[model samples]
Target: MRGKSAKYILKVDDDMWLNFDVLLRILKTGAIRFSLGGKCNYGQYPFRDPKNKYYVSYSDYPMSIYPPFCSGTAYVADSDVIKQILTISPNIPFFRLEDIYIALCLRKLRYEITNIPGFHSTKIYPLACLYKSPMVITSHGVSASELRNIYQASCDKDGSMYVPKNPQQLPERMILEQRWPKGKLARKSFKYEQQLLKHNLF
Candidate 1:
């Protein structure tokens, strides 16, 4: 990463709606330069049900409430933060929950996470709400059609799409039918994020 000249590293999941147009402008405007930015989830409890995919064994995480962590859907950390996390990772035991693990590392490093607007990490906002948001970044659990529609609306300068109606009235895609990649494939594709992190490219 040092040789590559990348400044910020953005980690995102496959099932998300990203407004790159708004993100590009935000990055160029240099709003979240120092802090880790994302839709942060606070005091989340670790799932304990054995049948649940996110289940964490009692031995793995005995705490009732976890430390504040950004939703796994999306988050950004600067190169310095990344390097620091790598340096400290040897001490913290391996954690299966990706976002929580990052938060643990950040906590060890005394790094703060800045909750940026429009991350919508847990749910998708209405199209109008998303389109109008200046800091709009990512929406979790979006279908392919939903992703395409959101991106198209972002480019619609003349307001052909993304009408500003009440959220309930809008044609909102509330469910995602997409199937996520299993264990190994998921780990591999995590490194497959966009190169826009390098040199703040649009």
Candidate 2:
């Protein structure tokens, strides 16, 4: 936001699924200030191998481990800290990883990031979990079609809560990772239906 028009900025990976209502919910609380929060990681070791995607040169980062930082998957930052981070970002050496790099800049600005509980980040939760949980849902490493389905599932207004593109296939398809096989996903829908019957979540 560059301290121009917005008070806070929420950054989330494209593949990750989020409930927009949750974002509004977080903002309406008027509690988030000064600090960034998301799926924060700690004591992460730098990859020494050159073949790895996250490999960092000793010159770039010679330390044994990275400072506590938020995962790039998703995070929320305020305009004040964002502006400060921008001012210092140029000074810090370039690191390929955006999340880690942002955290480094934040570290330079003397801001600490903590993990927020509702940010169901990183690991892909089951459809039932996404249906039942009223948290920040993030399903990383999903394909374009799968991303669309997951997004649709969360946003679906029907009490049935079935995916639009291909309901039968969606429950069977790999929504995010290839964790779910063909027929196993029906169970998720079963629980969702049960919840619909019990709580009548719209």
Clashing pairs in 1: none
- TM for candidate 1 is 0.69
Per-residue lDDT of 1-202 in model 1, one digit per residue for the tens?
3455977788888977676666666666666676677888787899989999999998999889988888888887677788888899999999998899998988888878877776767554434333444534686766666565555443345333433333333222321112333466545544322211221111
Instruction: State the lDDT of candidate 2 residue by residue for 1-202, as single tens digits.
Output: 3447888888988766665656666666755678887778899999999999888889989999998888788888777888788888879988888988897888887887757755655444345334334543454555566555555543444324432333233343434344534365656567544543443222
Location of the lowest summed lDDT over 10 successive residues in candidate 1: 193-202
Q: Count the backbone clashes (under 3 Å) in each candidate.
A: 0, 0
Model 1 regions lying over 4 Å from their true place: 1-3, 123-135, 152-155, 158-161, 165-202
Please report the TM-score between candidate 2 and the true structure. 0.70
- CA lDDT, every prediction? 0.65, 0.64
